[model samples]
Target: MNCDQRAIRFNCLGSSMIGIIDLPERPLPRGVLVVAGQPDSRLGAQRQFAMLARALARRGFAVMRFDRRGVGDSEGCDYNDSDVRAAVQEFCQQVPGVREVVLLAPGSGSAIATASACARIDPRVRALLLLDPRRRANAARTAHMLAPPVPAPAPIGAALFWRRSQPPRRGPSSGARLAGLAEQLCAFPGQVLVVAATSAWAGPTPAQAEVRQLRALVERAGTSNRVQIIDDAAPAPADRAAGGRLDGDALRAATCASWMVSW
Candidate 1:
């Protein structure tokens, strides 16, 4: 499979945001949206996002990555739902071959991805691939980074695609945000694949503690989902390090490919 890339721009709030898309000669209707956490550009740690996008594209998915508001080429003061929603919209609009989408959120960004998909912010979003899902270690930092979405809308069923973007409130405590995410996730209708990164070599546990929580919540959602635990050759790094310099990139890639085919 061969892949190519292009630049794309969209509007979030009053600001203009930019992203990159990896295109395959022939693409599946389901695309991928790679959400980079706030203060991090789409380039991801050491440009690993760039590498991942191309890899997914080669696997026959239309893949995309972009800057958060106020980061990279995007223009905005901070992160918000509108940023993720806008990116979702752009992904669907730009990739004519893509109908539904899957989100791949590496770390804290998993919080954002869960909010968007589980909350039903966009109808096109169908599944999630979360890598080492974990919350921020610092509560105050989490407050500074995340903004809570508006009260969720009633389930619209067939009306989902025509729904409008929900409003948002900025700077909530991590505890508050986590509680909200828990509630929404239990209602999410899509399948979730959580990649729990840990191992004896990884020096903690082969299964992450957060992975257990995530699985429990997802199972309660009443949807069929899967959890795949792969051993890390070394202790897992923070989101930044994991994204950029992990020696287990090939393993992650293989896992993604396998799950996607099974999906």
Candidate 2:
């Protein structure tokens, strides 16, 4: 079926956030608001998310994806903790006839989704779909970048160069902060689906400690939860050249998950 997509700007907490709404030619079953990763506008607006949104629309879901504050066409300088919460709150409130909300997030956006859910006293959020979340690792990277550099003796020219070349160091790791935020979100009442990339960071399997922490949090939340890890098997040459579009089976699985709840 042909999908109808519209781009619009809406005011949220005194800022204009840009978004695209996709509707199926037929009636929709429910509405989903997708949150994108850090530095990514509305599901990366990439082929993967766009294809997923279009697929959901075909399966009777009205999907909306937007640029977070300070990203893309959205108005803002930077997104802080509170702005993330406000953006989600506004997105939840603005979508019309949304019976249920599936907070879909990827990468760093997962923490934002969790925080937003935790901050809400309202019962609009029904489920969460976290695709390849990197809460701890992302936080760690951020902290490393922000951490203060140690001073060392150097020649005048060397010292000047070091001052310009050294990266800022901030206290506490982003991963640690995200863990705290995740704990808060787990307290909220909702189902969660975690999709983890097996080849995440092009490294070895996920750290046991990280996996254990995530599992414990999900269990403690008392919410319906499932974790799916993508395999790293190489595709056939023909398929590989096709740019890794999700297979039919993957598409079906995501659609089922997206529409799991009743409005």
TM-score of each: 0.68, 0.63
Q: Model 1: runs farther than 4 Å from truth? A: 109-114, 117-119, 135-185, 200-247
Report the Cα RMSD per candidate. 12.7, 6.7
Q: What is candidate 2's lDDT per residue for 1-263, written digit by digit as tens?
A: 67788786776568877888787666343466677666777756345667667777767677778777788788987665454455445555555556666666664544545545443644666666665555434655678478898786766887788988989867655457546646644654565555544543355555434655655655665543433223323234343324566364244335444436432
Estimate every model's Cα lDDT from 0 to 1: 0.68, 0.59
lDDT value, residue 71 of candidate 1: 91
Q: TM-score for candidate 2, please give it.
A: 0.63
Q: Please write out the lDDT profile of model 1 over residues 1-263, one tens digit for every residue.
A: 98888898888788988899999989988888888775568987777677778777888989999998889898887886677778888888888889888778764544544545533867788777766544343334567357775677686866764455555556665455544555444444565565655554645542454445545554565443443333333534543344476555555665676777776
Which runs of model 2 end up more than 4 angstroms from their true locations? 27-29, 43-47, 80-97, 113-119, 135-185, 199-204, 207-213, 220-259
RMSD of 1: 12.7
Q: Output the lDDT of residue 32, model 2.
A: 64
